[model samples]
Target chain A: MNRIFKQDVDNILKDMYVTSEMKSKIKEKAYSQNNKRIISFSKVAVCVAAIFAFSACVIGATSIFEKVKEKLGNTYETGILKAIPPKENTIYNNISIDTAAAMTDGNSAVAYIVIDDKETVKRIDDTAKISKLNINLVEGNNSMGYTVESVGYDKNKDTVIMKISIDGKNLENKEISLEATDIMSGLESKSYDTKGYKISDIINENATFIEADKGAYNTEEGTIEEYKMLKPDEINIPINNDKTIYISNCAIKDGKLYVQYKYKAEIPNQGSLYFRFNSGLDDYYNMPNVVRNFSVSEKGDICTDDIESKNGWCYIENIFYIDNISQSKDEFLNTTIFTEYDYYKNVVRGNWNISFKVEKLKDVFEGKCNIDINGVNITRYSLSPIGITLRGYSENENVSMYDIDPVVIINGKKIHIYGTSSSEWILDEYKNMEENIVFKYSFSNVTNISNAEKIILGDKEIIVEKN
Target chain B: MGVNIVQQEYENYEIHLDELMDKYGNSILRLCYMYLNDYNLAEDAVQDTFINVYRSMHTFRNECNEKTWITKIAINVCKSYMRKSWFKRIFTTDTLKEEGYNYNFNTNIDRENIVGEIMKLPQKYKEVILLYYYYELKIPEISQVLGIPSGTASIRLKRGRERLKETLEDWYYE
Candidate 1:
């Protein structure tokens, strides 16, 4: 090799030499005395003690549990009754709302009452009633109980008659009379609108009015109804003297509402309709079915398949699924699967499944013989007719599975038959199937099996030596 | 005879300490010097590196050669030391002063100007250049020390050299 001469190289080497010499002196000064002292007494004494304590606790508990279980019969009836306390019936009370007085207190001179009795409460809910009432409570003070401006039960029908006064003169009376069934059903359902109402008459009582403009009214009934407007804010009244029935907490949130009322006898399902008109458009529509179920307790189940778009667009984002297997109303055990779907209907992200199961060995190992495969250490061993399955997570590759070869070496001889062949074994085989395999085996002939202490299969190994 | 024995033991300690210091101390100091560009900080980093090596000497397996092992320790120490708030504040401010320190030395044809320009390169390019050219390390060795693929190290070295040439061209023309 040719000798290379570079000034920069020479400077760097010279600096390195000087630095190294200085480092040695510093090292000796910093560590020589301490290093000798540290070696004299083990530095890991505390850590070793902590590990020993933890191991002893775990081992002690395991052995104690084994002895106790052996002493006491492991039968389900005996063990469960001994372990768990008896069940008790818990009584729950409902909010009793004085329907008659609540309606009379609100200055509506002529009140349209719908009492939610026990039957009504059982069929529909308080939330539905409050939402319906809010639609009728218009923002105005009138002589006849806030002048029943516009009313709707839900998104289907509305009964609203607005008579506008311009310059202290009555101009027009626009009356919207919806079909009776739509009106009744609107009151029954969770939401309602007035677009299905038939306009019977639009009389300009004040003929000399300067302008007679028509405006549109949109209601929760999912319909847009046109109305003749004589003037804007023509229906003004004293804010303090307003006889409107104030219905607070009536807004729909998370696809459900809660309402309350009091009644002695079962009140048949009955409700009122409300509507609003502005520019031939309906603002209130059916809420989306994204939230399939609602429960009082925090522990409840949710179904993602029933998700439907409100108004044919928009979806719930950041949705989380909660599963309470013990208390879930669904038939399936408590298994929560969280998922996020994009606007294009693709599951963009989320955990696929989180579940746990317990099964008896008799049910798992049908009649198939258990086989401990050679050259592999089964972290989790299960046998079925198809093959033996091993469950383990790889340090290099995440989660994976492996199929154990039917034949395995034990005490120098290859044994093919291990587990019994039965229905239980078949079920175990199918249940343990996984998407990816983690280990592979290669057989090598050896004269003395006792001499072989360890077997390597792909990236994993098994130790045959006794401890 | 007792006095002579004590004197001989003292000599032996001195020789052993000196030999160990000569072999590893400069390498550790040079690594820190390259990163910090300050003699005192470089010496401190080397001190820390040696202390760690001495403490862990018993656990040191004969996996890689001792030089590589010590170099790895020094690099890790320098990285951690650089993370200290005081060290970062001091070094970042010092970089500005050192920016033009080499500028006056390039009087012949602006060699100092070339050095200043090299210092202005991005940290990644500067590290590659210092490791490859200054330390006389091949691309593969640089890759291993830096914990990057050899191909990536080679590419960075080539790009760094080209950038240095480009930066020097402006001074040369002037």
Candidate 2:
């Protein structure tokens, strides 16, 4: 009986049985209107193709062009070059203050304290002479420091507020409560206009300038300063000026800022202008030339001009002459000439001019150049002297020469080329400027002369002889 | 000539669909019934399996036989139904027990007692045994439907048999 029972349980679990009604229900559900529609659509497509093919054969032969067009259309195409809309530039300035020095004059006290817990009386202490200090927080600890903890109207009362524990417990007898008048305040901010700049051209180095409160004494009730924390609109400093403006913690994005400044008439016609931005101990300069003229038009046209400083002196002779003006409503034309000057007046260097039209009104353009020094080979079908075709040997067939290189030469100088690969023969390097080496070849009309010397790249000179 | 051939192929597919439904519809329904423990839901799952099979019929490479393909569809449908949030809420134990069908066996042993013992087995062991013994599929065939190695299927069957024997022993001893 036990053996029979085990066998029955196995049979009951293993055998799956369904009634006629259930099968009918499944068939009914499977052949629902939605399912039928999908199957019928597939069948119709196949029928349409068959009928189309039969009708085409009966009428006439299909052209190879049409067939190729259909084949290419069916193939997946992707990676379209998208046009990105140009944006306005926004500048941020950092303002600095000598907090330790300010506090020593009885106006403020710089305190660096790390609170391990706000509820507990524990803190990491450090002294920062400047208003800003680099603090690295240890994991699982709450830490921070204030340049001025608390300020009081009375000199004696101010000392008490500064000495009070940050944890809010245990106030010393000498400690004093902070009054609104005793609060120390200073200014730190930088600004630049987006009218002629790309977001990349705003230099962050040495961009900070600080202004401290003026009143030393006499007004014991405390002082309210108007324009006490002013950031200068113009950052003009003499060549030998020892005072350095330090700018730290700076970021640039797309936006607008008010730019109110007159161009210094002593600005040079050529060379490059460097804006020294003081950031802490190390000074930084915004390399405006490298960043300008970075983008190209939809027709693959790019300007080869470098935008120069409007305020400084530059060599004017090397500046490119603008032959034509094609202005769009959204576009702005900006041109600058850098001067070789010792103190903003003395001249020393040669000048180069860049003239390119841009679509957007930006203060800075982050453009780069590609100079191909190797000679370009001109083909018979070429429209310009810069047009060159390089043919690869026949183990590979039908190679489009456009894939070889994209560098276009304007007059005699090489310029920016996008989306094309350089040939192995061309040597490429990017330093203060990007350079490309191109090979120049000319085909002779007459029979080959035995005395012709082959041109060697990099070092060997080509010998040209009359045949 | 190609047009005539294409017409003949469509006629063949129509006949094949009818024969397949007649042969495997009942077995697929039963597989879903055992998996979900609900007859109405099991019937819906079986129907969904056939619809999907028909829609994707063009892409079906004849690597496996028709029965294996249908069984795969049925298993996938049941698993999908189990994953739905609403299914869990509707199929709680108290509700399941109320609706569960008791097999009326005419012996001194009660049918509900037997079913109770079977349901107590782990889901994996219980599923394999039900597919193997009730569905009457060979171990190798069960492996293909469940997408597991044949060795694993055999092990599941062995463990299931052992568990069933132990449950019987404990009941008898008590």
Q: In terms of TM-score, which candidate is strongest?
A: 2
The TM-score of predicted model 1 comes to 0.26
Q: Per-prediction TM-score, chain A only?
A: 0.14, 0.17
TM-score of chain B of 2: 0.71
Q: lDDT values of the candidates?
A: 0.29, 0.31
Candidate 1, residues A359-413, lDDT tens digits: the string is 1111112111222332222454332211223433222221112111234344555
**Candidate 1 lDDT, B57-122, residue by residue in tens:** 655565544555566667656655443433433444354232111111111112245444555565
After best superposition, candidate 2 residue A441: deviation in angstroms? 94
TM-score of each: 0.26, 0.27
Q: Which digits, one per residue and each the tens of the lDDT, describe model 2 over residues B1-174?
A: 112111235436444555566677766765666566654465557667767776556656656556666777777667555534235334532432222221111111233555455555655566677677656667877776665557767887888778777666643321
For model 2, residues A122-164, the per-residue Cα lDDT tens digits are: 1111111111222111232323221122211112111111211
- Quality class of the docking in candidate 1, CAPRI style: incorrect
